[model samples]
Target: MSKGISGGCKCGAVRYRGELSDISSFRCYCRDCQQLTGTGHSEMFPLVAETFQLEGPSREYQMAGGSGQPTWSSFCSTCGSPLTRRSERMEHCLYVHASSLDEPEKHKPSRILYADAAQPWDKPNLDE
Candidate 1:
């Protein structure tokens, strides 16, 4: 059986619940991802947009992605926890941050994106 994902912001101001099928998860090493996540890469599961839902208010920011399409990042304004991301490049999908999920421990990225942009000191052990 597939696991369901449900979570909220650090302050419980933004809640979401969803089920992802045909899973295609990855970690992005683009500079924008690094700056937004404050880490080497941003781990996300790209799910069908229709499968995701959000409750409560969130602040959204948009910028061009590596694909040169507008990408939106939404987060809770109250606690500043990153929530969801969507890109015009993948119109049918929503990229959910693994760190925002209640079952974060279960998240396993299957691939890495923008590998050439990766930081020298931070790299995922692909062997695992």
Candidate 2:
């Protein structure tokens, strides 16, 4: 059986539901990710196009990434919780923060990206 993912803003003003397949998760340690996640790494799950859908309007901001690609960061305008990131090269895909899932335990990062961009002080524990 395939169960979909459901989550929303802390204030419940924004809700989302989607069915994502071919899951691929990773932690990115680029400057943008560190700043956005407020941590050493930003965890995400690769989202296949057409598999994800937005139920309500989400606030989006344009930013630059380590990949030198235009990044669009989106979040709940009401609560300001980070929602997703869309990149130009990955237009067919959307990346959602794993922590944003209703059941975060079910989503785990599988790899690390931009390892060269990682700061000297940020050491992520990869062993589970």
Candidate 3:
């Protein structure tokens, strides 16, 4: 059996597990990500939606994406730790915040999204 990736929220109110997807992990610098993470960008890793499992108290916040599609941010209702991001544009996969992973060091972002929207102080290392 394949080992599942697992992690949870800060307050232990939310947890999730899933099998990794073929989609490459990426860093998003969009305004929504910045505001959600309270930083310049967000690191995301993808998991197969069909294999994703989430438990405990969580809430979702929806907003219009840069693509003008509805996007949702799921987080722990107790600790408010951002957990995942979902969008109408890509429903086949679940994008998890890399920092929310049990092994965040395993996250390797291969690409950058919304680089043009990236802040000056947090310039993306495009050469990666």
Q: Which 10 successive residues of model 2 have the least lDDT summed?
A: 1-10
Cand. 1 Cα-lDDT? 0.83
Candidate 1: where is the Cα deviation over 4 Å? 1-3
Q: Residue 6: error of model 1 in Å?
A: 1.3
Cα lDDT computed for each candidate against the true fold: 0.83, 0.78, 0.91
Candidate ranking under TM-score, highest first, comes to 3, 1, 2
- For model 2 the local lDDT of residue 76 reads 89
Considering TM-score, which of the candidate structures 2 and 3 is the better prediction for this target?
Answer: 3
Sequence-dependent TM-score of model 3: 0.94
Could you arrange the candidates by lDDT from highest to lowest? 3, 1, 2
TM-scores of all models? Answer: 0.91, 0.86, 0.94
Query: For candidate 2, lDDT tens digit of each residue in 1-105?
Result: 245777766677777667765756788887888888788888887667677877676799997766777989889887788888888978787888887877778
Please give me the total number of clashing residue pairs in predicted model 3. Answer: 0
Can you write out model 3's per-residue Cα lDDT over 28-106, one digit (the tens) per residue?
A: 9988999999999999989999999999999999999888999999999999999999999999998999999999887
